[model samples]
Target: MHICFICDEYPPAPHGGSGSSYRDLSEGLVAQGHQVTVVGVYKNPQWHGGKGVDETINGVRVVRLPSSPSWLRYKLQTLSDRLKISRWLKCEHQKNPFDIIEASDYGGWLRFGGPAGVPTIVRIRGSNYFFDVELKRNGDPFEHKIEEAALARADFIGSVSRYASERTLDICKLSHRSCTVIHNAVDMDLFSPSPGVSRERGLIVFVNSINPKKGIEQLIDAMNVVCAKFPEAKLAVIGQDTQKPVDGITYVEKLKQRMKPEFLDRVIFTGRMDRYKGVLDYLRRAHICCYPSHMETFGIAAIEAMSIGKPTIFSETGPGPEVIEHGVSGLLCNPHDALDLADKIVAILSSDELAERLGTNARCRVETLFNKKHWVQRNVEFYERCISSNSHENGRCGCK
Candidate 1:
């Protein structure tokens, strides 16, 4: 079966969950002996040789279209480009007809898929309702429109979590049967925890982009409290500022300023990494993993840390609560509570026996939940079903 992926995000230029999520799916599909082509937007084209057409990289065929000025300059424009992507794919259909088209997000699939006569599935990353909750009101109408269309028009829909799946219906006013929930998979080999892997007295690793929604500020505040007790504690941050620095809104800088002076000095920023090498290296070097994000649809970083036998502390929201079985895998604190996070960080760092036990279980959990070979087979079977369904639909000549 041939699968065409219309993904809004991909690696080197990060767009959070969608980029990493599509990468994992692409690799898994290839291993399962399926032909897959990805269409994504690249922030900079010069790095990819020539951008507007097909280029194979990392064993996956990718076509990156030049993102329009609107897509590049403003958030609203990016969400509004489903028609643009639809037109691009429609033109490409002449060169080679796609058997199954999968849109990893709402914007394009919502606008593009039905027109193509292809059975389209838009994998919901999460619902924009969270964005509404964050803003204390509804999100942008343009963003809302795409998600609504995707939910209404998609031949089938899948979401990252049950929470996200249900929320999709609520936001779009669709039925319960409208979407299926498919959890993301992890590469257990890369993320398994190492036993007795102790670093210097207090090394805390905080990965993910340095943004407010990620709850980095709360993590920093919690670390401040924990650091006072263990003065040697250091929090190593392994992501960069995702947005262009606005005049008065420097989130990362603000975090540093608010943190205790001594604790802030211990916080090392490694910027955004192009690949997993830098992240893997830092994870191995750290004594513990601290993730305080509230809006994570799935906490892959924390899951990866667990696979590596490292005990992780994360929030009680979304994937965090789903993955960390509290005291079983690691500890779960309130999403943005500084006091709660501080207590957990200190407790994990102080206890060698507990950390060792949690690390072992964490690694085991990754094997059970995210085994690569297991997922590869599942994806292959799913692709076959999608193709079969498409063939069946096309051949139907009931009432003319």
Candidate 2:
């Protein structure tokens, strides 16, 4: 099957979980003898200078379009960008028709008419509404409207988690049949426990952008409690601050200032490590992985840690409970409660047997549910179903 992915972030781009997840799926599909092409937008001025580039990365053909913004047309920029993407897709489609064009909800391109006639699938990796509510941001009303419009036109919508799917449907008032839940995959081979890397005793790692929604403040507060019980315990924060300061100080700086003088020495902030190697390196060394995020469509970092056989702790909020079985596979903490997070962290640290049991269970759970092969196969089947359904409806495989 021939598939094309339209996403704003891809490899070598300032990406988060969505970018990495898309790249993994595309590359996995290509390896399974499927033709995959990715159409992405590059806007990072520092890296690519917002210039278009076409290249093949690990078997997947990636075409990046320049997204250099024009302040003069700021209000109409989104519409113009969508038009530009649509034109590019049309041109690409002429060269080689795609069976399915999966456009991510990240950039709201599908809200406008996507490539004309292509069976477009809007894969929602947390909609704008979800982020606005979760992150407590008053986003542009026009952007939300644009996303709603795009979702309405999608032939099929896939979400990384049931929580995400249900929330998007409720917020957007989308039809039940339009969206389906598909959990994100983790590369088990790449994330398995490393024998070469020695684990750090009492090291608690948090891997995500240092932002309020990520529950960074809660984690920091929890660390204070954690250190009181276990003085040897250390917190390794790995990720950059994606958002600016809500107050006068940046979140990173605020965290630094908030930490007590004594406990400050126990905390280490390694801002934005190399996702490919750096993250895995940190995970391999850490004794416990804590992801107390306020909301997540699917917690990729948590799963990655679980895949590495690390006893992971996630917030009960959002999709964490869906993936983790509380004390069985991994521990779950209250998103806003620092004491609860600290208690959970202490529970694992105090009991070596419990930690091992949870870690082993987590590894098994990831292998059973979040395996890359299963993810790729599920996506391929979904694409086929969407194509078949489109063919039946339009007397062809393409959208009308």
Candidate 3:
């Protein structure tokens, strides 16, 4: 089946998890011998790629358009043309007339389908309502209203976690079909256990945007305690300030201002990692990893860390706690309690036997649950079902 995948983020222009997930899912679907077309906002500064129609990537033909004020308007903005979206929709219709349009997030592009005549499948990745919590925490406001319209109208809907599934219903007010939950997947091959170098000082790592929702503040506070006990303990923070780093708690300065003097010296910020392999190398080298997120639709980084056989710590708040049973595959802690996280970190680091046990369990879990084949196949089957239902409902086979 030919599927048209639409998202604002994708490979070579990634800013967050949705983009990362799209790249992996697209590649996996392609491997299953399905023809796929991707429509993404052009985000490259060097190529300045976006919406002016389309471009090609690997084997997937992509339509790139102007990105929003977040930057790069001249090359891809639909605002000035105003009627451009209709033109692009017509162009896409002429090209292949997508059998099913799968979107990320609820009701964003009203142009996709349903009453508009196309079978639209919307996948709700974490939403802007999530931004509301972070925004209020930082005294900010709405930023993605344009996308919100697209979400409200899609014919089919999905999310990566139950937390997201529940939140979508609450935000859309049960007006649309309830969301289907499909957990985000990881590349098990690239992330599996490897011989890694451990820090003699015992390092703890956190990968993800330095946003408050990720609970970086809490992680650092825990590190503060860890540092005091084991002054030799170091902290490495991956990812740049993708979301303004919680107003004042820049992971770098969070260490400087809030952390004790001795602990401050051990903190390192590998700002805005643009390279995945490099970050993975860092994960392999660390003794422990933690993501005490305020909320996680799916804790990809935490899982990725576990997949690499690094003993990881997940918060009791969102998807982290859900992914691993306490004291089984990975350790769980309060998302807000620094001391609790630090204590867990110390215990895991202090016991070689315990670390080996947790790390071994993590590897086995990913092989069983998150392998690329299982992740991709499940989503492909789900997409197939949506397409099949659309065909049956139209009173014709695969047509309007």
Candidate 4:
């Protein structure tokens, strides 16, 4: 089957979980003798400059369009992205028709499916309404409408987690729609236990952007208690800092300003590591990893840590419970409660036996459920159903 993924954050360039997951799936699809292409309008000017990029990496074709003009209004910019993507798809379809087009549900990019005459699957990575609720703010009504339209047009709908799908449907008032849950997976071969890299005794690592919703503030608060309990304890934040600051001061500086004087030097921010070169090595070296997100649709970073056989502490919120078995696979903490988070961190750090037990369980769980090979097959099966249903000229979605 021929498949095209519409996304802005494909790997080799900087990207989040969605991009990483798509790369794993796309590359896997190619390995299985399927044709796969990734088309996107990258935000980074340095990536493509004024011209579009057409290249093949590891058997997958990647086409990156130039960034939209930064000066346009937010809605106008979204329109520009939609038009550019639609035009490209239309042109590409005319040359050699794609079997299916899959796009993340962040923006209404798949709303152009009617023109391309290809069945589309909108995988809910994240939505504006979902983020607004996470951050406790009134979201843009226009963006909400855009998402509603896109979901309505999707020939099939999928989500990374049941929690994410349910929340998106409820918030978007599309509870009647049928959505499939396919957990985002990691490359088990690349992320398995690394005996060559010795683990640091008191080093705790956190991966994700420095943002409030990520529960970094709570992690910082927990670190204070952690540092006091174990004087040598230190936190290594391994992600990019947010472009804008929360108040006048940057988020990292704010975290520093709020830290206790004695443990001031304990927190280290290693801004955005390369996924292949840096993240795996960081996970391999860490004694324990934590992703205390206030609201995570799916915690890919947490799974990445778990894949590397780390004793991970994920938040009890959102899909954490679904992904992990609490005390079995990994520990779950109340991200909102600093003491609870600290206690979990302290538990794993204080006992080598407990850490090894949880780490072993964590790695096994990932291999059993979240391996890339399994997910890639699942995606192909799902896409085939979507394409098959579309060929029948039925008005309803395959998921329905």
**Cα TM-score per model:** 0.89, 0.95, 0.85, 0.95
Q: What is the C-alpha RMSD of each candidate to the true structure, in Å?
A: 3.4, 2.0, 4.1, 2.2
Clash pairs (backbone) in predicted model 2: 111-150
The 0-to-1 C-alpha lDDT of every candidate, in the order given, reads 0.71, 0.85, 0.69, 0.87
State the lDDT of candidate 2 residue by residue for 1-400, as single tens digits: 8899887788777888888998999999999999999886666665445677788899998888877476747657778778787778778788998788888776677755555656888887887776886667898788888887787778888899888888877778774555777899899999998789998999999999888889999999999988988978999999998877776777788898777888998998999999768888989999999999998889899999999999999989889888899999999999899989999999999999999999999999999999987999999889888888877876233433
Separately for all candidates shown, the number of backbone clashes (residues 3 or more apart, or on different chains) is 8, 1, 19, 1
Winner of 2 and 3 under TM-score: 2
Worst 10 residues of 3 by lDDT: 106-115
lDDT of 1 by residue, 95-202 (tens): 777666777544534554533556667777754654565435657776677667656666667777676666556657775555656667778766554455445558
Instruction: Say which candidate scores most in lDDT.
Output: 4
Q: Give the Å shift of residue 299 in candidate 3.
A: 1.7
Between candidates 1 and 4, which one is better according to lDDT? Answer: 4
Which residues of candidate 4, in runs, are more than 4 Å off? 67-72, 114-116, 246-248, 395-400
Q: Candidate 2: lDDT of 41?
A: 60
TM-score of the candidate numbered 3? 0.85
| Position 174, candidate 4: lDDT | 83
Off by over 4 Å in 3: 42-53, 68-87, 110-117, 131-149, 196-201, 243-251, 395-400
Better of 1 and 3 by TM-score: 1
